[model samples]
Target: MGREFSHIARRCERAVVTAYRELRDGGRGDLQAFGACTTLYRIHHPEASMTEARRLVAEWIDHHVVRGASSPTDGCDCA
Candidate 1:
């Protein structure tokens, strides 16, 4: 499981990082933020399928959510 996530993390690093930063700065709810990220990704990668964009967004969200949960005082209102 960890190895799988590591592989995914490497594959989607750019999208995940950009999406996380954008969503965090925007301070929007998960659904709205994820949707916005997906749209932005699609715009940047027009050839990319919606499913791929959505999957990247979902993985990014899950990773950050878990990270935030682990660090309650990271100054990110993940709570």
Candidate 2:
């Protein structure tokens, strides 16, 4: 988990990705976990619209979990 999330500079991004991965591994379906992650993001950033939360969450999952890339992601400024 540390190795996977260490590259993320923002707390929100790291948190969303970690929650998504854990949810997926803990027998939750893909969409279910995704929804949970989106909700998690919105919880942290109420100013974000549902669409924004969904996009950021999806990007985080793809970058950290699916692609395993550490490239900086585009999203919230919270750290």
Candidate 3:
């Protein structure tokens, strides 16, 4: 995961973290943000299928953003 994500800059890391937190919150708005990231990933990597992009993002979220089952405010720095 580190190797694949080493290229991400600080801004992107923050955005990914935010997306992971929002998804965990569970609501239509949060889902939209999650979908936006996936959608952007698809647009940027047009050759990649949506499912693959989604899987990659989910893996990234699980590995880096959300490792354990903590409270909604536990892992994220969002207030």
lDDT against the true structure, per candidate, is 0.55, 0.87, 0.54
User: Highest TM-score, which number?
Assistant: 2
Stretches off by above 4 angstroms in model 1 are: 1-16, 19-26, 68-79
Report, for all candidates in order, the number of backbone clashes. Answer: 0, 0, 0
How many clashing residue pairs are found in candidate 3?
0
Q: How good is model 3 by TM-score?
A: 0.48
1-79 per-residue lDDT for model 2 (tens digits): 3345677898889889889888888999999999999999999999999999998999888888888888898778787
Q: Candidate 3, residues 1-79: lDDT per residue as tens digits?
A: 1223443444444466556565666664645766776775565567778787677656556666546422232222222
Name the lDDT value of residue 63 in candidate 3. 61
Which residue runs of candidate 3 sit more than 4 Å off their true CA positions? Answer: 1-29, 68-79
Report the poorest 10 consecutive residues by lDDT, candidate 3. Answer: 70-79
Per-model TM-score on C-alpha atoms: 0.51, 0.90, 0.48
Error of 3 at 51 (Å): 0.8
* Worst-scoring 10-residue span by lDDT in model 1: 70-79
Error of 2 at 41 (Å): 0.1
